[model samples]
Target: MSEVFERYERQYCELSANLSKKCTAAGALDGEQKKQKISEVKAGIDEAESLIRKMDLEARSLQPNVKAVLLVKLREYKSDLNNLKTEVKRLSSGGNYLSARDDLLESGMADTLTASADQRSRLMTTTETLNQSGNRIKESKRTMLETEELGVSILQDLHQQRQSLLHANNTLHGVDDNVGKSKKILTSISRRMNRNKWIIGSIIAVVIVAIILILYFKLK
Candidate 1:
């Protein structure tokens, strides 16, 4: 498990470094190159998020104390990734809206034609955004299912432990009952032995007293 975590950590570090490099280079690039770099960074961000989620699931299998520590580190990594993403997004979007408006205005087309073209462009963009959202939703559903399975597995373990504890408790109760019976038997035996001792001592006293009376009568 630790090995898996370390593997993910290494992958994340490489991805993060690559994203940083791209983000830095994005500023120096022109036109298509800049857009391509931004796209790559976006892809890297998705991968990083996926890797972090995997790490979170892996952490669930660890001991609580260890999981807690790992989760803290993962959270920090997530935050760092978010910052990188923010930087990349800002770089990518800088002047993008203005550029789009300028292009639309400079197209030298009729007003109605520009409006129609802009409407089509906006529609395409919305469609693509919706598709991306759908994909994200599916991914989220899959992650939820996996988490549910893990929860069920942990619950099963707890159920088994509960059964074991109950069995142990029953066994202890049986032992206690047996001990009580043994103690009662011992008490009965002790009482009987004491009564026998008293009877024997009384018999000896009677015999001695009768012998003295016999001698006394004979002497008289």
Candidate 2:
């Protein structure tokens, strides 16, 4: 790895880890304290973004094989960063709404019917928000599952293709072996034909010579 890439990657990891801790800590805190931690997280997010950009630039500058691997890692980092931001937002919104509801319930108001109406309305709103968040979580899970299944399907296809290639290669080898055998058989047959031709010629020549000797004897 290049020095710049290594440095930026290390820094990004540290920053993201710290942001995750902050996000988890924010869940334990409330009011101004939680808000402060969120602010800090947002700042860290900005810094992480900068580091990611730098790392991307460095990764792109590398060789193709190395660049692909590094870019994959960078995408994971980006996903994690996005998740962190989402979590922080969820925590911030939930805490603020709950805190406000609690304050309202604690107030000493004389209009009991209006207070009841307001409380019911706030409860309904909070319930809707929770439902929306739950729906979003469910959707995210579905998407992740679909992605996993797709990856598995692609791997299976590649495996089948590899098997097909191996089978083709084996068949080709068999054909080559048959071709070699056929060549040897043809060569042997050609040699036998040549030998038979020579033998036939010698027999004809001997027959003609005997005929000539017989005629000469008769004439003598």
Candidate 3:
């Protein structure tokens, strides 16, 4: 379960890094660092969601008490995910509209510029929505951190429960060690399948050639 959390944390950090990279690449020098920080927080939400899913899957075969904690966390994470989605849509729509507005301004269309401004004004009404979305995203990140803390508590509970029940499960029991070997085998299979594609074409070509030769001989 902690493994799941760790994976999510890494992914969250990566997402924040990616978002920061995007801001920097766009020449947002003054605010790039700030944007990156916000992105990091937003990424934390993602990390929490991933961990919740992993926990849910892992908890399915566990005891009732273990399942209950995981289920609660999963539900909380899902609720947060939904809210984050709404915020994302709000921000993305505003960002897209602004981008379009910039394009319109750059196009140098005297008639369209007035119309574009009108459209931009309409987008402005959604300003609160954008701000609210940002707040919600931030809130979700905080919630995710709370969820992670809860997970630690639940994991400790699970450990205690296991001790009482004498659950003799190894963490590595479900892990597939031959993943790389499996990938290699899949690649080999794919290559063999692709070879058959050309073989069919060659067979068709040979058949056509044979038919022509037979026809030519019969005509002669």
Best by TM-score: 2
Question: Model 2 RMSD to the real structure?
Answer: 16.5
RMSD of each: 16.3, 16.5, 37.5
**Tens digit of per-residue lDDT, candidate 2, span 155-218:** 9999999999999999999999999999999999999999999999999999999999999999
As for TM-score, the candidate ahead, 2 or 3, is 2
Question: Against the unseen true structure, what C-alpha lDDT does each candidate score?
Answer: 0.73, 0.74, 0.53
Candidate 3 lDDT score relative to the true structure: 0.53
Report the lDDT of model 1 for residue 64. Answer: 93
- Report the C-alpha lDDT of model 1 over 180-207, residue by residue, as the tens digit: 9999999999999999999999999999
Give one clash count per candidate, in the order shown. 0, 0, 0
Q: Per-residue lDDT of 50-133 in model 3, one digit per residue for the tens?
A: 655675676665778867865664564454445444433333332433343343344443244354334334433433455567
Candidate 3, residue 122: Cα displacement in angstroms equals 37
The residue pairs in collision within model 2 are none
Instruction: Candidate 2: count the clashes.
Output: 0
